[model samples]
Target: MNDRLTAAQASRSTAVKATLDYPVIDTDVHVNDYTPALEEYVQQYGGGELVDALRKVLGSRFNTRSNGKDWYQQTLAERRYNRTLRSPWWARVTRNTLDLATYTLPALLAERLAEQGADYSVLFPNDVLAPLGAGRHRQALHRAINHYHADQYSKYSDRLTPVAGIPLHTPEEGIEELEFAVKTLGLKVINIAGGVKRPIPSVADKYPAADHPEVAKYAHYTDFYGIDSEYDYDPFWAKVVELGVPVTTHYGSQGWTGRHSISNYMYNHIGHFADGSQAFAKALFFGGVTRRFPGLRVALLEGGADWGAHVFTHLLDRWDKRNREAVHNYNPANADLELLENLFQRYGKDLIKDRTLDKSTLLLDSLGVSALPHSRDPNEDEIDDFALAGIESPEDIKTRWVDSFYFGSESDDRTVASAFNAKLNPLNAKINAIWSSDIGHWDVPDLTEPLAESWDLVEQGVITAADFKALVFDNPYRFYTEANPQFFKGTAIEQKLSSSHTK
Candidate 1:
């Protein structure tokens, strides 16, 4: 029965692939690292003590119960007592044991690519991602994990490629790891955290985290790399563009704001990645990263594409109402005080008959002086908030938003239609939505299910044939190749990419 089920799954996806002339590039396929082997490398870098510490503090590197102390180990009462955010359990596929093996074994994954209907896949490595949460030992652990993945997956470069995790807590730190991961280790792709959680200035000034860990955890803000960061991250971004790599982030916003439900994991999980992606996108757009580096390509993964389109459309809507010229429509200085008073006298016979109210109070209220006596309006230079974004027209927003960013929509996300809806998007622009088969995770369950699932969108006429091709192939191709022309150099899809005029 299991054999039949597996065959049926593969056949469906394979049939979907047969309809496409272009090769499908699964941009966000996940893979796990063998924990025991990964820990050996971690020990090599941070020693036995580090391994023992991680085991006690984080459980084990890839263990489902690992990473956090509160949720899994704690009783329901204890979880409630601490307000601990629920952690994920059974994140990997175990019932489909072959699919489970395929994630850890790169060679096996490469061999099974045809069944999954992907010619090539960019692997998001669980081990490469493991080190970033190791705190003080992260820099060393990152080196350990990167080296491990390079050793394990380099041989399977033809079909499967793993992304090296670069922690950008600081720009210098990120550049150092990127240098090793790409230049030294020859890893082609990289994934970065969407934002860094930093201590709020007022809170950190009074209560140091070491002195007050519980107090400090909540007293923090996320510094989305492009905006309001303590240190300028331009050096890191410059290095990224200079290195010919696209900025891809798989960050999520769990335990952030409303996502901190203590018992239900799904409560914390739903739309968290989208929230993180939106935060990152807003920062990049408003902070002038897109304006400064027009060629920079950023892919926000697993959030789906609708949010990007929503942001784009809203930017146009906001700019229309609040551009440099339109904003003056609400200026208090432009209000006719005499006309207002005459109208008030005409309309306020009974309302103001008994009152001897000062007319200047009305003027003060109209000028907004009565409400905000403390903080005045911003400087002339600061009046235009969109100045940093350099959005002079809708075209500018389209260029900056569409050309600079790609959204990763997983197979089952119906909201992906927003990406291809040219009429709905601002300036008739279609967002660049890449196909991401989030296999090996709990959401996918079966490795062969994604391509067929995505194909169903096309069958239902939710998106056209060309739109489906763009989602599955062209967008992913452009996302990688435009960032680095040689991104697919030695891979199976390299020839197909070079031969096509798809970009």
Candidate 2:
């Protein structure tokens, strides 16, 4: 037994120990069963040329030759374990013992929750959005994926809030899916890619011959492109605010322009999101979406927070000037300022005093700063581990070792809170930052480990406890629930033990 214990222990012991009791709500994690899930939906519904293209793309990634099995069979065998593990309604109905053990029964997640004391967790689909947007799918295929995610939510309840995936080929179709997602699936979040195909101009506008210089330039930039445009998204955003659902852009793995010229994978994928998201945010702001539907909220997932801060400041500066110019435009004839002053005398107080207006302003203030957790690949574990532990003063330990499990304790001990406050002070107290452990991504280890590491950073004075809480619990809770109050009930954990419970 002693020899076996020694053999079982390896170099990863310290790394594992350091993360054993960190409380966390992993906002990003994935489960991929792409080929089978896509194929089954396609085959059962209808397989057209688009379906064929989907098969070819997915087959290249998951299908193998040695087995000589059909794509569905091979995919099923490979992904059966993960599929069963997912807390989808099918799993619940079938009572897959493995899924029940791992996800549904709360045994697997609860163990981690108990150790780290995590209050809640939100789940996003890996196979759905990453591939769904790449090609066109039959309407039925879209319905199947949507239904599958809905089933996941029904089975797991708050433990997994499945984000809905929309087919963006047409604005009408996007709206339809959005409606079903909220009404049928009870989906709180909607995920759309950074790209959508633009509409063609009318025949009369086809002007100069096909070979015209202007035509060539236009085609090079906009022709047959599958990039998402802000104009096309107006209707969708309108409905989102009406229904009170937050719109999220999950950065797709594939590049938008084309595969060849793209240099770094991260830069290509994340760069497109940054460019697209910035444009999207600008359109919503200037297009008067925020002004129109003041209650609406938008979240940029996996996109870093620093960029959001930069963009908000830039927009405020620009808007202030633009508003001033607009006032000048209607000046003397209408006496714009005096007219506004007269109007203000009549309605300004009423408008400013309205509760809804106040709420909308607050909502915009919160969304002006969005964020994702700072992630370091597990390969850099050593540096991160050392940094976390080194925060403790030797003399402090003489009294009692700090309990890293408690949220915000590390931040308080190491002055991390003060630093975060100072950095965010310029945003006019509109710091809508949240902490997320993009856990379950292949690059990240189990959730608890990172939470422990974050605490270590707090101890080292890298981040504060209040900021840590905001990142991990408070911010996400407020963003998901407050932005759209009806969708999420705060996280609740219930435990059930079997008559003959076993570890």
Cα TM-score per model: 0.93, 0.57
Give lDDT for model 1.
0.83
Question: By lDDT, who's the top model here?
Answer: 1
RMSD of candidate 1 to the true fold? Answer: 3.0
RMSD of each: 3.0, 19.1
Quality of model 2 by C-alpha lDDT: 0.46
Instruction: Compute the lDDT of residue 121 as modeled in candidate 1.
Output: 92
Writing each residue's lDDT as its tens digit, candidate 2 over 349-457 gives 7655654334323333323434212353123233221122221322211111111001111211232243245455333433444444454443343333555665666
How far residue 60's Cα lies from its native spot in candidate 2, in Å, is 7.8
Per-model clash counts, in order, read 0, 11
- Local distance difference test scores for all models: 0.83, 0.46
Give the distance in Å from residue 105's predicted Cα in candidate 1 to where it truly belongs. Answer: 1.0
lDDT of 1 by residue, 110-162 (tens): 87888989999998875566666778877777787788888888888888778
- Candidate 2 weakest lDDT stretch, 10 residues: 398-407
* Candidate 1 lDDT for residue 278: 91
